[model samples]
Target: MRMKKVSFLLIALVVAAVGFFIGCSPAKEPEKMETVRVAEVTRSIFYAPQYVAIEKGFFEEEGITVDLKTTWGGDKTMTNLLSNSADIALVGSETSIYVEAQGAKDRVINFAQLTQTDGTFLVARKKPEFFAWEQLKGSTFLGQRKGGMPQMAGEFTLKKHGIDPHKDLNLIQNIDFANLPSAFASGSGDYVQLFEPQASLFEKEGMGHIVASFGKESGKLPYTTFMTKESYIKNNNETLERFTKAIYKGQLFVDTHSAEEIAKIIAPYFDDTPEELIATVVDRYKSQNSFATNPLLDKEEWENLQAVMKSAGELPQTVDYSILVNTDLATKAMK
Candidate 1:
């Protein structure tokens, strides 16, 4: 598409401008690096704080070498934590609810939360004069799998606007995340919920136009968080504290820096996307306060996430937030 081509051109220009300057800059090295395996659900701009920490040597400065894995979905990322393949997982806070539902003996606990609101934005194939939640009635929408926050957020946004998610729209759930763009291009659905880079990428291709940011209707909901098993957090307090400290620094760096600057720093992770588009995506997130300033979990927002899931029957029993999240490490990191 013409728009996608333009996006690629813009990235080329930005890369040419900053690539040389950054490549020549010295990368800070740590005297000793302690590798920590962290499983991330997705490599998205919404998770920019972690990416910023990785790119800007914040982790290295904390004497941590990060082994970041992209599991592509929250369930798998949580499994990484459950199986001990990963030391920690950066996942949707809603994941904690699902894990609690399973009643594992060594339950995973969240010590830090990064995204306080849903990062998903709605994209429609054709732009219309009036883009409203009610407009989705009678339309087919490409939604994420059940239990994932993206889909749950979409459902919440619909209900808040007086549209019943079950009765108002024909929702599709079988599409793989990586195939969403192609699926959209083929007209499988009229609307799709996506995080940054994917949403920005589709917009660049002129395949779809952003209709609504679900965050507006969903309000402040706990989106993504960092979690480890109770035993791991208990045994590796120092390491976990250092990780939070570095991520906290990353949050501050993103807040103080321009979107373009932050984009450049994390550009390597988004190499597939045009730098210009990635910067645009970062600007959107910056405006939304998508990342948290500190890792400490917000009680009210976490409750909202649980409420959303319980509304959908994804959670049967009430979950106590205190048991699932701890603030001491993040508190110490802040101090």
Candidate 2:
């Protein structure tokens, strides 16, 4: 019995010594995060994939730290990209196309396409049981500045229905997007076109209701894309690749999940909005297929967007497609 007790003590001492060495040994180092500053063109449910990525910690998973800054409008957002204040500009691909057409020294090259569907909704001041685009013929519609995507889209849709956006409807220009909903609610404009949550928010408050969905009308336009200077793209290949992979994962997460699930994930990132309204807004976007499944901004969509821009007189000249888009990075990201 003594011999057995001595053997047991010896085993215990060996185990204790092993454990002590393990405890004193160095731990595995945490990942050092890479930073990527993104200048978001506009804050809306349209860019839900990006918001989902940020909220779900996908950036951290990829060892990337994303600093998302909202620049309110695409013009300002593109400027941020031009000045090197932002590594990527999240705006319509047309903005970059225009820059290239204008002969910018460092042209914006689109790498990733975030959304494929137009996110604007034309909300009539009064809700109508039967909706039609022709109903807007004589109405004074609130619109943005000429080159803005929402205004251009609104013009495109109206013209498609045989109504002259410039002559058939009185379009009020240069209205701040923030004031559009309230301005119409206060009987300032007969109709107002705006991005999600605002349209639903207006509907929720009984101020205005949707008359037309631009996404459904526009049918797969290149709505939102991520671009950077050609020099930046050539230099920071690894950082951009990792960032794309993380956000592309977020895009897939959104595509597979229900609107309600994504709404909960992205609610905190948007303006202080209630979950139900967020869900409603998300459902509206989901129904229209607003997001792209991958980061690829294909040639067909790019051409379609340029056509729309040219139709609206926003582009001075057509740029060579290869010069404006570099999909190789996006391809690497997915792999």
TM-score of each: 0.88, 0.91
Worst 10 residues of 1 by lDDT: 309-318
Per-residue lDDT over 136-241 for candidate 2, one digit per residue giving the tens place of the 0 to 100 score: 8888989866787777777777778898888988889867878877787778888888887888888888888887888888767778888899899789988888
Name the 10 consecutive residues with the lowest summed lDDT in model 2: 302-311
Tell me how far the alpha carbon of residue 245 in candidate 2 is from the true structure, in angstroms, after superposition: 0.5
Q: Write the per-residue lDDT of candidate 1 for residues 250-284, one digit (tens) a residue.
A: 98898899999988988889778878887898899
Residue-pair clashes per candidate, as listed? Answer: 0, 0
- C-alpha lDDT values of all predictions: 0.85, 0.85
Alpha carbon deviation, residue 242, candidate 1 (Å)? 0.8
